[model samples]
Target: MTAAAVETKIPASAEWMRPGRVAVLLFAVLSLVAFLLPDGVLPAWTRQLPAEFRIGLDTWISAALKWLVEDATFGLFTFKDLTRGFAQLLNVPLDIATSILSTGLLDGRGSSAIQLAPPLPWIAVVGVVAALGYRFGGSKLALLAGGAFLYLAVFGQWASAMLTLSSIVVAAPLGIAVGLATGVAGYRVPLLRRIITPILDLMQTVPTFAYLIPILFLFGFGPVAAMIATMIYAAPPMVRVTMAALEGVPREIVEYGTMAGTTPRQMITKVMLPAARPQLLVGVNQVIMLSLNMVIIASMIGAGGLGFDVLTSLRRLDIGRGLEAGLAIVVLAIALDRLSQAYAAGARKRDAEGGLKPFLFGLAAFVAVTYLLALFVPPIATYPEALQISTAPFWTDAVKWINVNFFNVFDAVKTFILLNLLLPVKRFMMAQPWPLVAAMVGYAGWRLGGARLAALVVGLALFPVVTGQWDYTMMTVYLCGISVVVAALIGIPIGIYGGLSPRAWRVIEPAIDTLQTLPSFVYLIPAVMLFRVGDFTAMLAIVLYAVAPSVRYAAHGIRNVPTMLMEAGTSMGCTQKQSLRHIQVPVALPTILLGINQTVMLALSMLVITALVGTRDLGQQVYMALTKADTGKGLVAGLCVAAIAIIADRLIGAAAQKLAAQRSGAVDAT
Candidate 1:
């Protein structure tokens, strides 16, 4: 060959031999071979770990937990006594909050024989909310705050909503306190951060139901168990956010505080924390949202209130009632989310006129007047039963109409998807020999990162096998894979369109926010109603629960792409489509991958919840363990789920890093 021709051939060969291209080609070949194999199954020898080699971690965990509860003691106290005492201590404040929000002390008999104040009148509650809203966020927020409470009252959900709020009032602060203290410790101690980081990751990824069983055993099934579970589930994010905020504090500011002779305690409380106020409040916001998300799930173990109402309505397939309760929850979530966000953003600026005193006086006067009027005007004290407007009938009719008119259409679409798309993908994945699957993941990890990541991926991929839960783990992989694919297909285009247009963004952003903030349980009800309870229904619920993050991140990434590049493309006579295809998407790929990572985490979290709708995945095992009080089984299953999450998170994170590096390289080349 001529020298020029040899050079051309060599360059082409090098391109094909690139690590990423080689990894993809290798994976594709193995997958294709696996698919063509008979019964779409691996050889029997390779299907699972040997029986003797399998670890009985669940058994050991169950035994340990039992010993702790029944036999273990510290000085004079057993674990049961300690747990019971703590439960009793927590319940005192919970009972006080519930009574004040619901029945009021004046209307009920008490052991102490001290008459307490009655529940604040609905009108007074509205006035106070509006006043606080106006003080923080002006007239628009005032309307939103007042309107949400009014809807709760007028819809006759006042008692249930208040009950839920009472729990949140306690749970949120407890989560914040625990989270802040842990976060501070983690920040100050490097060794603690190293230990806490992985624990936090696992705690955040493990399904909430996994811990509920242990809590149920210790605290018994009631509000106290639910409260503890909620706190555990909600506090991780707060800790993470707090640590990040503290870490992000400018070194200059810390130095200034030090030079000013501030003590360590004063440095943290007066200087560091104040400077990190925005992020601290963001952590608070996260705690509130997570607590609210747990409301309905916590109800399964006997936490009462609106969540209980929603659960009951759904169990009966009472669409209208479920919808009403769901809407109320959404409203509550939005109101709290917005108020906290506004406060964190420092929306409140002290007014020159009267500052804080007049606002306090006005609030007191509103309370007194409303209380006095409630003594005579019954509707002001409690929303009048006669005037209550129930939307349950309307929602019930809507559900019926949807079932009657669209049943065949939905069924046909569902059949096509299951038969043609989801089933085949699942079979392909399940068919692979475990060793081959692990190798493929390891190769991809190595291509993106290096040998260390390859080892990590292989270890995580083999985790379920060693634990003797390989089959259930594969089932979870199938569900998560299908849900993520569908979510991306639907969400990415909407995100791109919205990103490209201001008007569309304005309309789309709020809808995405609403979808994200709505409790995960609410999605399940509609899925069940529309499709009935099965794998498809479960997948549908996962898709709805997980799609919002994809849309949000996609839009944010595309929109944030440098404007100069788009203009340059225009100047070069490139069409908008060309610009989007060739420039915007490439730049945004890293961010979009992060979105997919979030979607994976969300789908895994929903796995156990979706199991409630009947699917024989690992989630079902967790649910079964919960019912049987098998702590070992539940924890093992939960850990398998967490393992899956860790694998996906690591792989996606590595891929995103690679993409970011490539983008930087391309920029430098230009």
Candidate 2:
């Protein structure tokens, strides 16, 4: 083909080459060197370092950190004091759950006491859900809703699932109500947005463990505390997301509403919110996912049902039980996710279908099936070991095999990483003088964000050092760095290839969604089985969990690059690689940066769960605080993590904004 024809086919090529045998050779060399290198390479390397390095350089940093943690640092906040305060606060929820468990309707006394909440008659719920689905989309969605409810019934988990569902039924709407109020307030008032934004960021980024202690202490256990915790923990995302979506609704629509004699509330309800439905739905999805994610964690605080089952199974290392519970959770998640998604898609279908006739039929079918079974079959209780799916032999054999074969290999690798890499890197981060660290962070902020971002980042970075979590915070930073690096290594390239191919995106999207929805805890078992405990397994878990965002963002960024821009590159006689490198990448850089930012945030969020695998970081502190019921300690540690998240978010997001502005400015100048 002619050069022009070739250019039109794609774009200019940026020279690229695949390595031939280099990777294998490099690996061999590294392996050889690893054997040759003395294990003491780390100790000697650190031994020669100056004593004045990080220690004497950070006097003010140490003092500030010490002051921030003084109450906990000196053991001044006694466990008894914290425990007593928690007891006093648990009176209400404790009373309610106790009444349900101890004596009442469904208190397990008389035949009538064994039944609870009327089961919504099953028909009503299915009808509502199917109606919602039909209203949102139509036949496909109606089938999905009908099927999901049927699965619950046939699987013999209908009652327990419904009990869990009841909390969500209460919690989600409550979240939306709070979110709508907060979102409206945040949008209308600059000061409220300013205050709520940081809190929202903290809530979104901090591990769930941080919230549990406070909720447990304040409300005690059971569905109430669980509900309260779920609301508090999950509501911020909804509120923030809703506020952003609503605020972004077309000004013209609001003006039109005003011109049409609408009041402010009418404009918001009838115009802005409707126009922002896609984003609001995303908020709803986030709320559902977050609430469900916390369900298992909430069980630890006294919330019952599947979460409790999952917790019990995990504690006993009963993989079969855990898998069943996890599967139930996943099934519930899929049901809710598909049902909601269909509802969103069904909106268009609603215009065609006209009414609820189709939904009603499906609902009637579900009710007939569920009620007939519920009336006849005695309530299915937890099965005996013989009946349950037991992976004990398999998991035990697998763990034993790994312990025998890979233990030495993993131990050696872990030692090298901890001693040679992670420790020194952590020490260096912690060692930086506060002023120097602030200056560097401020510069990064200014370079990427501007003066406002720079100021915000510097302040956030300085806070944890002041709070005496400097060391622990540094450790979190290190783990995040490791996870982000690993995730990017895996995600960015996968995203690029997927972005280049529509067929790939189609295949990959479902996989990505599954990975994203899979609870972070579910992966821990396999990770521990493979890598054993310590930082390696934890890091691997974080990386695996965090990779989804990076891949998703990268693919989205690349795919969303304007078609006109691609055509322009082709018109200019550029090759595909050249166009991607010189044009597409530059334009997509801002969005790609956003993906990186997400990856970091997600990695940081997973750190607390990683702590359960035995990492001596802030996550450990948060986890320990939860078990000990040390609210203040947990809060401080949580804040420290929040500080880290906010600082990184500001820096990266600011950088992306700056780059976007620069690109726009250059385009404008041209």
Candidate 3:
């Protein structure tokens, strides 16, 4: 036959030879081969890295940190001296804030002495907060703001709450400032973005507790150190959000600013920043939530506040006191989250009215009236002791009742889960030969992102093994694996319900916000109370801490499905379930996957905190290392956790990209 005739008869084979398809086939084959191999079956060399070839990164990091702390000097000042100087500088404001919040300016020496700047009375503080809320957000927010503070006072938690607030008052603004500057710089400079993006990713992934040891060493244990850690922990999200917001500003707005004869500064300040206000406020909200979340964790190193109260209660097994403090944290978080969201939504509307001056005047009037009342009504100034209510007894009785009635049931469920699910999965993961596991991961990475990603994944996987942290790392993976699965099971359905119904959305969204805003440490309280401190309880805490993002993203993705498509499906006589299954679910799958990615990261971040509830994962190693001042071990373990997160991020990110491409292709074809 003629060559042309033969070519015509044989259909083009190139479609089946696509890189993605080829990669997948290769991954499947390789993974199957690896899986079928005996647990210990590997070439001798692939079992572990040779001792001499190991990098000793831990030793180097420790040495560098040691030099910085002990020997490194800059002129007359050592690094420790410099860190302490900054800490002391920060301490001035913190001390003043504490004094104002707790003791007032009278110094508790004599009430008659001429007071310097006296602490604003509790009534005045509440009035100012409510006024500010109303000024920014209207009556509903005013009620929420007023009610939260009142709850603090009536519960006799005013002083502890104030202490926590004082730290947040100091930390949140500093975080915002630093984040804004860094974000702007990163946006303007590609090199800076490249340098800082990875750092921010690392910072976000690392557990908050992991930060405390390094900070404790540098600045010593105090509110200052806690504040610094809080800033570091909270600032990265703001930086990331700000950069994203700035980058996402419409090009036309910038051009408009330039055409209007605006300078570079004016363009950014007036055009880009204003355009980016929604996202920037979201970043601010994140900072506030994260700062509050850090409160209890920071208490571990001597930061005083409601967090300290909660910690003390937990240590003493005073579930009643712990719950009260935890609830206060939750209430404070919800109020701040709502206030910030409301303010962001209303800011543009208020700006259009040109009513700033009247708002300020009204605020000033409220403050003045409250101050006047404070001078006359001492009970209003400071919450009267006689009127202070204690719910601790009620909570204690509740806990006792729950323990008496429900402990056995919870214990049985915990045992069943541990035996039927977690233990087998963990053992299987741990028992896998390192070579086979690494090969499978590498192959999957190759399937998703070619040789470069494969190399990156292999390197990340090997790092833990080389550091002798493989067992602990696998333990973490097992714990996170179970948590993510359970979260997806719980969160995805809630997300679907919320997506389909506005009423459900309104109800679920706020609950998700509250759950997300609460501190990681807070989850441990109930877990400990109910399940009583073990791997099971720890997993439960991680699940609670990690589930919100999945639910949120799923709902968002589903809600955002194209109206035209929905209508088209309906015109074809597709029922709701049929339409959702064939249309919305397919389109939303990519976003749902991204939500799962976020859940994994959140679970990893919670690992160290969960260690406090007793789990022998990498988190426990870091915790132990911190207690012993073993910088090398702590840093190594933390890096291992970051590595796991990075690997998961890259793999899932690639899948999401592929799904997006498919979605685009389908749209184009239509």
Best by TM-score: 1
Measured with C-alpha atoms, the lDDT of residue 193 in candidate 2 is: 91
Q: How high is the CA lDDT of each candidate model?
A: 0.85, 0.69, 0.82
The sequence of per-residue lDDT tens digits that candidate 2 reaches over residues 49-148 is 3333322322443344344434333266644455445555643444444433222234454454564523344444555566665556567776777666
TM-score: which is higher, 1 or 3?
A: 1
What are the per-residue Cα lDDT tens digits for candidate 1 across 1-670? 2323222221221231374776678778977987787862566757778889899899999999999899989989888999999999998888888766776764345564554566888898888888888888889999998898899988989999988988898989999999999999898889999999999989999888899989988898888789889999999998998899999999999999999999988999898988897788899999999999999989989888889998898789887898889889999888888788876775334443446887899899989999999888887888889999998998889889999999999888878978998788778777767788888888877776789999988998888888898988988999998999899888888888888888999999999888887777788888888888888898999988899888888898899876655555666676667677767877787888899999999999999988889888899999899889899999999999999999899988987777777666555443
Model 3 CA lDDT for position 572: 63
In TM-score terms, candidate 3 sits at 0.90
**Highest-scoring model, lDDT:** 1
Between prediction 1 and prediction 3, which has the larger lDDT?
1
lDDT-best of 2 and 3: 3
Q: What ordering of candidates by lDDT runs from best to worst?
A: 1, 3, 2
Clashing pairs in 3: none
